[model samples]
Target: MELADRVESLTPSTTLAITSKAKALKEDGHDVIGLGAGEPDFNTPEYILDAAKNAMDQGLTKYTPSGGLPELKDAIIDKFKRDQSLVFNRNEIIVTIGAKHALFTLFQVLLNRGDEVIVPVPYWVSYPEQIKLAEGQPVYVKGSEDNNFKITPEQLEESITDQTKAIIINSPSNPTGVLYTKDELEALGEIAIKHNLWIVSDEIYEKLIYGNDNHQSIAEISEELKNHTIIINGVSKSHSMTGWRIGYAAGNETIIKAMTNLASHSTSNPTSISQHAAIAAYTNSEEEIERMKEAFEERLNKLYDWMMEIPNLSCVKPQGAFYLFPNVSKIVNQSPFDSVDEWVKQLLEEEKVAIVPGSGFGSEDNVRLSYATSLDQLEEAAKRIKKFVEKYSV
Candidate 1:
C-alpha cells in the first residue's frame, strides 16, 4: 500500500524505539531499568481524579466547543494571569488532545508549503516532524552545550530567511531541561519582532522547574510579544495527568479561531471529562504538584551526581524538567562503540539500561536519560551505565 508523501519523510522517534527495546527486554525476564519515559512517575492527584469521576457521573460526556468549554478556558486564563501575569480572553484559546496536538494544529494553520520554521538543536523530537507534516521546513540552529543547550538570539537571527514564518522555543525543554531566563527571552523576542515571525512557545514543563529557577513565558515579556506568541501547555506534565490528554493554545484570536476550525473537522474537541479534570488541576491547591516537583528535583540531583562519576560522561545541570541530557561523546569516542546510538543499544542489551540516544534530538554527542523513575531504578541505571562505560573503556 502506498502511503502519503508526507508520511514517507517522517522519521520514526528514537525515544520510542529505545523504550520499546527496553520493554521487550523486561518481557524476556531481564531486569531492565528504563530511563526513557517523558512523564511524571506519579499518578494523577486524587482531587483531579475525583473531578473526572464527578463529571462522568453528571453525564458530562457530550462534545464541547471545538475550542474548549468556557469554564475550562477561564481556568486556563486564570492560570496565566496568576502564574505569568499575562491575561487572555476566551476567544484566544483552543483546547486540544495534548500539547503535541496544539503544536501540530499551530503549524498546520500558520504554515504554507515551503515556509520555514527555526528549530533549536536538542529540540523535543516532535517539533521538526510536526513542521514537516505541515509541509513546512524546519531549519535547525544548534545550541552550544556550554550555554546549557540554549540557542542564542544571534544564532536565531542567522537562521531566518524570506520563507521563515515561525520559531519554536521550548524552555524547560524536553530531552534537555534548560530554562531560558527573562533576559534571554527578551533578546529573542526582539529578534522575532524584527523578523516579523510568530513565536511558538511550548511551556509544557513549566511547573516542573527546580530550586531558584522560574519558568518565564516569552509572551509575558511585553504585550506586543504576547500578540506574536502562542503558548502551548497542558496538565499532563504539570499535574501528572499524562493520560488525560488536555492541552491548550493561547494567542491571537484569528489564528486560534482558524486552529479551532481545523480541530472541529479533525478531533472535533478534546475529551469532555479530561477538560473537567484539567479544571480541577488548575483550580486546586498545588500541593500535589509541589510534591511531584520535589521528587524530581531530588532524583535529578542524585542521578546527576552518579552519572558524572561515570568516566567521560558530563551533563549540564538542568534547571527545570525531569531529564538529564549528558554528553556521551567523549565516552563514545574512547569506547569501542562507534556512535551514541550504538552505545545506547549496547547498554540496553548488556547492562539492561535503556536511555534515548541524542541523534533523535538532533545532537549525536549526547543521550537523554530521564529521572522520572523511582530513585532505586535511577540509581541502578546509573551504576549499570557506569559499569558498561568502564568495561568498554579503550
Candidate 2:
C-alpha cells in the first residue's frame, strides 16, 4: 500500500541513518565507532530515578492532564524563574513527549496551508520536515561560516515574506553548538516584533553550554518579545533524560491550549511515570548534572584540539552541545568523492567510523561528528579519520 504523499516526500534523518548503520556494523563484529548519535553518554541521575520509584509506589501511575501534571508544571515554572527570569502560568505550559514532539505539535497548531516558517541553515534536521508536515513552507535563510553558522538580523529580515508566520531560533544550536549572545538575540527579537512573527525558541541545550556565558532566552528579552516567543525545552539534554522522553513548551495560553487539545487526541499525555521523574529533575539542583557537563566540556576540548591538528579539515569550535560540524571541502576537492555524503560513506565503510553528512543538514562541504562518546573512542576515531584524510586529500 502507498503511504501518504507527505510521508513520501520527506527525507529520512541522516543522523539516525548513520547511527543505525554503525550499530549494524558493530553487531556484525566490526570495530565501528559511531559519532552520529546525539544523546549524552551519561545515565539518569539517581535522585530522579528514586522519584519515579516513589511515584509508582505511591500509585501516581494514572494518566495526567493532557497538558501535564500540575506538580510537574509547577516545577517547570520554578525552573524558568530560577534560570531565565521568565514567568509563566500553568495555562501557558504544556508537557510533551519530548522537545522534538513539543516543536512538532507547535508547528501543527500554528501553521496553515502555505504559511512560511523561517529556518536558518544548517538547521536541526526536523525543522523543515515538521513544517512541511504542518503544511507550512520552510523558508531557509543561509547561515554564514564567518558568523559561526548563525543568521544575522538583516538576513532574517530579508527571508520574510507576507506569508511568513514564524521564525525558529535554535541558539546553542544543534550540530554547530554555536550560541547567540543577548544583544544578537535582542536584534533578532526586534525583527520578529517588526514582522509580527512568532519566535519558536528551541533552548533544549540551555544547560549544556561550555563557555562562561549562560543561556539567555529570547523570551527574557522584553515583555513584547516574551508574548511573541514560544520556548521549547526539556530535561533530555540537561539531565540526561533522553530515554525518559519528557519535554515542554511555554507560550501564549491560547496557543498552548490549542496544542494541548491536539496532544489529548494524539498522545493523551507524556508518560505518567516520566512526568513524575521530570518533576524531580526540575525540583533539585544536583552536582551530577555539573559533573556531566564537565565531562562533555573536557571531551569537546580534546576533540577540538585533535580535529584542528588533522590536515584538510576545519570546524568551528563549539561553545555548547557535543557535536562538531567540520568543513571538509579541502578533502572533497582533492579526493575523488563528489560530496561530503560520498566522503562520509567511504569513511564508514573503510575506517568504520560513522558521521552524519552535512548534505542532510543542508550543507555539502562538511560532516557532523558527535563527541558524546568516550575520550578513547574519539581519539581512535580521530586517528582513523586522519589516516583516511591524509591518504586521500591533496
Candidate 3:
C-alpha cells in the first residue's frame, strides 16, 4: 500500500520515540528513568477534571462550532484581557485539538508551497517537521549557547527574503526553557512589522516561568503588532492538562477564520468536554499552578547544581519551561562514540536513562534533559549520567 508523499517524507517525533523506548524497557522489567517527555509530571488539576465531568453530565458530548464553543472562545478572549492586557474579538480566536495542532493549522492555512519560515535553532522537535509537512521551507537561524539559545533582531532581519512568510517565536522555549525578555521581543516584533511577516508566538509555557520576570507575549507590547501576531497558548502546561487537548490561537480575524475553516473540515473544534475543562482552567485561579511551578523551579535548581559538579557538562539556568538543554559536546565529541546519537543510545541502553539528543532539535552537540520528572528520579538520573560521563572521560 502506498501512503501520501507528505506522510512518507515526514519523520516521527524524536521526543515520542524516546518516551516509547523508555516505556518498552519498563514493560520488559527494566528500570528506566525517562527525561525525554515534555509534559509536566503533575496530574490535571481537580477543578479542571470536575468541569469536564460536569460537561459530560450536562450532555456536552455533541460537536459544537468549528472554531470552538462560543463560551470557550469568550473565556479565551477574557483570558487575554486579564492576563496579557491584549483584547481580541471571538472571531479572532481559533481553538484546536492542542497548541501543536493550532500551529499545524496555522502553517497549513498561511503557507503556500516553498514559503520560508524563519525558525530559530534548537526549536521544538515538531516545528520544522510540521512546516515541511505543509510544504513550507523552514529556514533555520542558528542560535548559540552564548546567546542563551536566542536569536537577535539583526539575525532575524538578515534571514528574511521576499519568500519569507512568517517567523516562529517560542519564548519560554521548549527543550531549552529560555524566556525572551520584553526588550528582546519588542526588537523582534519591530522587525516583523517592518517585513510584514507573521509572528507565530508559542506561549504555551507562559505561566510556567520561574523567575521575577513574568512571561510576555509579543502582541502585548504593541498595538500595531497585535494583529500580525498569532498567540498560541493552552492549559496544558499551566494546569497540567496535557491530555485535555485544548488550545487556542488569537490573532487577526482573517487569519483566525481561515484556521477555523481548516479545523472545521479537519478536526472540527476541540473535544466538547475538553473545551469545558479549559473554560474552568481559565476562569479559576488555583494555587496548584504556583505549587507546580515551585516544584519545577526546585528541580531546575537541583539539576543545575548537580550538573555543575559533573566535568564538561554545562547548562544555562532555564528561566521557564521544564527542560534543560545542556551542551554535552565535551563528552560526546571526546568519547570514542562517533556522534551525539551514539552517545545517547549508549546512555539509554547502559544506564536506563532516556534523554533526547540535541540533533533532533537542530543542534548536534547537546542533549535535552526534561526535569519534569520527580525529584527522586531527577537525582537518580543525574547520578547515572555523571557516572556514565566519568567512565568515558578523555
Residues 109-156, candidate 1, lDDT per residue (tens digit)?
A: 999999999999989999999999999999999999988888999999
Q: Report model 1's TM-score to 2 decimal places.
A: 0.99
Best by lDDT: 1
lDDT by residue (tens digit), candidate 2, 162-267: 9999999998998799999999999999999999999999999998898696888999989999999999999999999999999999989999999999999999
**lDDT of candidate 3 over 87-146, digit per residue (tens):** 899999988898999999999999999999999998998999899989999999988889
Give TM-scores for every candidate, taking all chains together and pairing residue i with residue i. Answer: 0.99, 0.99, 0.98
* Candidate 2 backbone collisions, by pair: none
Of 2 and 3, the candidate ahead on lDDT is: 2
Ranking by lDDT: 1, 2, 3
lDDT of each: 0.94, 0.93, 0.91
Q: How many clashes does each candidate structure show, in the order listed?
A: 0, 0, 0
Clashes of 2: 0
Q: What TM-score does structure 3 among the candidates reach?
A: 0.98
Please give the range of 10 consecutive residues that has the lowest summed lDDT in model 3. Answer: 9-18
Better of 1 and 3 by TM-score: 1
Candidate 1 local lDDT, residue 246? 92
